[model samples]
Target: MTGLSPVFPEAVLWDMDGTLLDTEPIWDEAMDALAARHGVPMTPQLRRATLGNNSVDALTKVYDAARLPESGRDFDADEAWMVAMVVKLFARELPWRPGAVALLDLVAAAEIPMVLVTNTMREVADIAIETIGAHRFVATVCGDEVAVGKPAPDIYLRAAEIVGAAPGDCLAIEDSPTGAAAAHAAGVPNLVVPSQIPVAAASKRVFRQTLAGLTVDDLARLFAQARTDTPA
Candidate 1:
C-alpha cells in the first residue's frame, strides 16, 4: 500500500461495484449464467476480461468467447436478462464491503461532498444507491450516461463536474484497475482497495487489501501525499 497524508480532499468520488459494495460476485453470477446459456463455462480468462467492464461490454466479451452470432437483438436479450438477474440479487441483499459504511459515515460527518461513479447502467446504479443509502452522495454517474465507460475517465470526469469540483480536488476510492485508471486518467487521485479482483499500482494512487478500519484521519494523510496537480 502507498503512504498518504492526513488531509481530506474537497470532495470524494466512490466506485460502486467492488469498492463500496461486494456486488462483483453477483455480477460474476450473472455472467456465468449467460455463459451457461451459451454452452460455455465461465473460464478464468473470460472472468478476468469482464472485471470492471460495463455490463454490456461484459456481455459482449461473453458473446465473443462463446462465438455467438452477436446480432443486436440477441445482445439486447442477453443484456436485459443479465440486468434482471443482478436486480434480483440486489433485491435479495445489498452487500457492503468492509468499512464501506463506516468510511461513508465519516465522509458524511465531515460534510464533504461525494459522487458515485460506476460502470453499471443508471437503473441498476439507482438500486445500489438505495441499498447503500442515497443520502451519502451528491451525484451519481452511470455507464450509459457517459460517452465512454471505465478506463476512459469520462464517467469520472463527469462525476467531478456534477460535484462542482476539479478532478484534482476530488479523492476517488476504487477497487479495480479499470476504476482506478479512470480516476487517474481524469486527474483524480484514488485509493484502491481491491475486492474480488486485484488492482495494480500506478502513479497518484494508493492500494490496500481492504478498507477495514480506515478513518478520516487516514484519508487526510493519503490525500496529503497524493498529487493535487493534474497535467494539462
Candidate 2:
C-alpha cells in the first residue's frame, strides 16, 4: 500500500498455475506418477523441462526423456492419464500463492477487468477457475482453445482481445519464464512474480518478490515502468 493514487491499466492478464495457484507441486506429483507408468523415474532435469508446458508438450518432453520410441508412444492415452491424475489432485485442494487472494480482492474492488491466460487445457483450467471463483475474470483463454500455448503469445493476445484492451494498454502478471516470454512476445508489459523457477530480466518485465500488500497504484507504477523500459 502506498500514498500514490491508483492508476489502473486497461485490463489485467493473469497466469493461473504457478502464478495465482500453488499447483506446480501437484503437477510435479502427477508427472512423477506418469514417469512411473512409463517405467522411468522423473528426473530433476525432466521435471524442469516440463514446467510451464501444456499437457501435450509436457508429455512429449517426458516421453523424450524416457527414451521411448515415437512409434511406441500413445500420446492420446498418456495425455488423458496425466490430465485425469491432475484433475483428481486438483480436486483435493487448490492453494493460492501468498497474497494472491488479496491482490485479486484488490483488483476486484477496483473494478478492473481481468482475464486468465493459461497453458493448462480448458478441462483443467475450468476446474481451477471454479475454485478461484470464475466471476473474477471477464474471460479465460486456455491452451486447448488456441493453436499454440504460452511462449507463443497466442493466449495472451486472445486474453487482451477478450478484455477489449490493446496489448500495450494491459498488464500481464506471470510466474514462469514461459508465461513471461508469451507476455513479452505479445508486447504486453508484465509484473513477474517468480513462483517455482527464476525468470530472466527483460525490457518490459518488472520483478517482484511477492504480491502481498501490493496496491493498485503499485501495479500502475510497475506497468508504466515496464512500458517506459521497453524498447520502442
Candidate 3:
C-alpha cells in the first residue's frame, strides 16, 4: 500500500465480470455449450465478437452467427441454458482476476466508497457476489436496473448518483473497450485493467497491464493526473 493522498475520487465504480472476477471464460464456455446443444457451433470468432454483452445481447449475436432463431421461445430457452451453465461455474468458483482483491481491500481500507457497475443482470451478478463478498460494495448497479447498459453510460451514471458522487468525480475501473467507452462517455475517469480482453487507450481512457500490486497511492496518483487531463 502507498501513502494516502489528500485527494480522493468521490467514488470508485467497478465492472464485475472480467474486471473483478474471471467469469468471461465461463461466459465463453457457456455460450459455446449453448451453441453445441442446439446443433450450432460457437467459434472463437463469434465468441470474441460478443465478449462483453449481457446475456440477452450475447444470445442475439450468437444466434445470428448460428443462423438460428433470435427471439420468442428460442432466445429465452438458450438464454436460460447459458445462465444456468455459468451460474453453476460461478457457484463452484468465482475466480478473481489478478490483483482484484488487493485493490478492493486497499481502496475500502482507505474509506473510499465503492460500487459495482456492471452490464451483467442483478440476478447473475448476485450469484457471483456471494463468493466475492457482498459487503465490498455500498450498492450494485446492474444492467436490468438501468435504462441502457454499458457503451451508453446509464449504469455508470446511475451508480455515481447512488453513491452520491458526481459522474466527473468518480473513477471507474474497467476491463474492456466496451466498458472503457461507457466510462469515458459518462465523463468519469477510468483505469482500465486488461483481463480477457485488452482495452485500447483512447482520448478519455487509460490502461494498465493489471490491477496487481497497484496501491491506493497508484490510484490517487492516477486519479489526480486524470482529473487534470479530463475535459470540463
Best by lDDT: 2
TM-score of each: 0.91, 0.94, 0.89
Candidate with the greatest TM-score versus the true structure: 2
User: Each candidate's lDDT (Cα)?
Assistant: 0.83, 0.88, 0.81
The reply for model 2, stretches above 4 Å from the true place, is 1-6, 230-232
Ranking by lDDT: 2, 1, 3
Q: How do the residues 41-80 of candidate 2 rate in per-residue lDDT, one tens digit apiece?
A: 9988788777898778888887887889989889899888
TM-score of 1: 0.91
Report how far residue 31 has shifted in candidate 3, in Å.
Answer: 1.3
Q: Which ten residues in a row have the lowest lDDT in candidate 1?
A: 223-232
Candidate 1 residue lDDT tens string, 10-98: 89899998889998888888878888988889998899878888866787787788887746338677778877878888886878899
**Which tens-of-lDDT digit does each residue in 1-232 have in candidate 3?**
3564458898999998899999888887777787787667887777766777766667777667667653433766766676677777777777889999999999999999999988887768899888788899999888878887877888889999998889989999998777888898898988888776666656556667889999997897778776666433
The residue ranges of model 1 lying beyond 4 angstroms of the native Cα positions read: 1-6, 70-73, 228-232
Q: Against the hidden true structure, what lDDT does model 1 obtain?
A: 0.83
What is the clash count of model 3? 0
